[model samples]
Target: MKPQHPSVRRISECFLKPDIECLPQESKQPYYLSHWDLNLLPIQYIQKGLLFRKPSEAFEDGHPFMATLLHRLKRSLSSALFHFYPLSGRLASIINEHQASILVYVDCVNTPGAKFTHAALDLTISHLLSPVDVPLVVHSLFDPDLHTAVNYDGHTLPLLSIQVTELLDGIFIGSSFNHSIGDGTSHWNFFKTWSEIFQSLPPDGDDIVSISRPPIRKRWFPDGHGPIINLPFTHSDQFKIRFKAPELRERIFHFTKESIAALKAKANAECGSEEISSFQAMSALVWRSITRARRQPQNQITICRMVANNRAKLEVPTSEDYFGNVITTLKVSAKAGEVVEGGLGWAAWKLHEAVVDNTKEKFREAVEQWFECPCTFRLDQIFVTNSLSMTSSPKFNIYGNEFGMGKAVAVRSGCANKFDGKVSSYPGYEGGGSVDLEIALFPHNMANLEADSEFMSAVSSPPHLFHQ
Candidate 1:
């Protein structure tokens, strides 16, 4: 694909103040992390799109619609931040004496405000809606450098950063956040709250409580665990292997309701069980297809790591509004030859079994074991060297967030630079039971997967391939 060059102008950048005048200040307020959070010790922020098509009314008059829209957006976001105070704060490190050395504790403290970067581009909404390469289009819509940074001493970057770009006939709202603060569920809740506040003004104005589920500041600690402040985790020496995904390209593949049903039927027939879900079927199909495309050695293992939402499954119930990460990875694997010989049904059953195996008791046991060690995560060691992993749940109501405008046309994950075999799934923009899979693979592998007739069969093409 030929490279695309577009002009993006940085209009203005500033820190928007929260609407609340006073915030409760505890000299040292610590936020506890679950075993799941510690495992993903250092994760790139969740960067995704909140795309809005051009409004119907033309702006031929002297009024500048872009400026007006931005002003309204800024105002509403300020109000939303008042409810999500943690996002407006920063993560601080507390050093205390442990055994022979020092221990570091990351506490949520200080308000530096979320960074807001506003820019405009010459590109049109059609360019984004059309069939364009992921890098060219997505890179321009978002600021790739906008992510939280952590130093060795544990001094961390801001919890949140947002970029609002104005494209001709569309608006792109991009957000990135520190994973230590929350997970996808928390991310979506903040956006949903912002949208509600934006859509409907508080009856008493911005002074009253508006969010449906304002986040709870209190952190949960399991039994036998007291105010655990120190994090002894460290990245493994095999860090290079964790990010070994080479020169890769990304493509968005769509699966319609019919295609999903066909996959489920075939998987169920193969397993001789009607209990396989659409997600399980789709996951199985993709895993098998990718393994085939990669054409790994027969003795090698092909693994699939599915990220599970542990909110409802946790032994202790966390408030729906509880802030912080509550997720874990469920892994299934087979020898490369085993996967090739077993077919889609075999792969799907493996995935289904893994999900069922993560019972509440198992989750509790895992947490209990984590306390015994409590070391920081070494990302590369978490999963098998060349395994495939998927994040971002399809259950998140990303499409429903409408900030006084219409629903977003699409959603995207910002971890574009991740290693190969990383995939994120979101509900398709089109309504029927469908899903959009964002896949990242080495260039040759991607080309091979695209050419595979069986894999390509379920993928729906874009409406207009306007590329010249």
Candidate 2:
């Protein structure tokens, strides 16, 4: 049945630049894109949002309330940008004099500012949480126009666009960032900082407190890798088709501390090793269930690609505040029959080994190998066949983001960069080893996977209904 919810309608739009102009002496040249950033050039923008119950102090949702919100948000965001100034800039590129290389950079000098939008939705928190699957309307909470736009689109569009939506009894802060500018670490860092600043404001005064983690503008490069890596294409027209993402049904599976602990224990017992982490056990269960759901041929190969962070493994230690992508993908494969019949523990042990092999030396080698040909990730790798990939980390403090409102009621993602077999995991609101796995799969596979008894046994849902 069609979701019984109101459509979102845009009300206002504006740019929020740095509150204080940066000094030219302090100003600098264009910030070059790292090879890690370039590898995601074909990917779509990262559009995600944090939902909150309506603020405790009640006021009419008329122009006065929204107008005040727009004013305060713009101010707080502008202040936040002073530290994360690159987000306010536009994407700029220049072809070398020899015309052999195309260099992409962020024009920090211009400081184009992040986009802030105000929209209205006559929907309630209940409308979102009651659904078995995420309501389709939830996707539109972020701007609809940029839903499928790739990362390179940052050249013409605002590098960062945030939509502050007013719901019937809640608010949704939807953010869309240029994927090349940052990964989930950089993304949430900005949000967490903004929240801190927003909460510190005194409604009328702008005494923004210092943020916990400031942006670290240093982009990482492996030794011998070019500080000035060039794109093969001279013109933007040639940088196309990173890969097409498939539209799939998405469902959020909640694994409480108890459920995850049990899954981990079982996995360790089966492998005769107590080292299987909760994440690996959960991944194994999901992978095995998904393979069963697809009903692939017995001998068909299936792969699980997990994104690993390189902040600690960088040739040099990278602060978590570094404002760019610093991660790589790790893959584990087995035939469909082997994965399905191996039992959760056996499959999890395989995953544990993959994680252990991702050492600092191994990461440096991968970076060097990339410079050899220099290519971005493609869909055929993990999405086109009996394969799946995981991104985002449960360790991220997404639930802690509070912009004067209470802690986030839930975490959600937009439609961009999503495809069949893509999974995003978050630390469950209840915390303490709990996890929320947002899995995307072919519509048929989703239905079948949900029916798998072994999978459903550890799953919990219907996110606790919100109260303002």
Q: Pick the candidate with the highest TM-score.
A: 2
TM-score for all models, in order of appearance: 0.89, 0.94
Considering every candidate listed, which one attains the maximal lDDT?
Answer: 2
Query: How many clashing pairs in candidate 2?
Result: 1
Clashing pairs in 2: 88-113
Query: 339-376, model 1: which lDDT tens digit per residue?
Result: 87788899899999999999999988888887776655
Q: Which lDDT values do the candidates have, in the order given?
A: 0.69, 0.82
lDDT of the structure predicted as candidate 1: 0.69
Residue-by-residue lDDT tens digits, candidate 2, 317-376: 878888899978889989999998889998999899999999988888887888987777
True-structure RMSD for candidate 2: 2.2
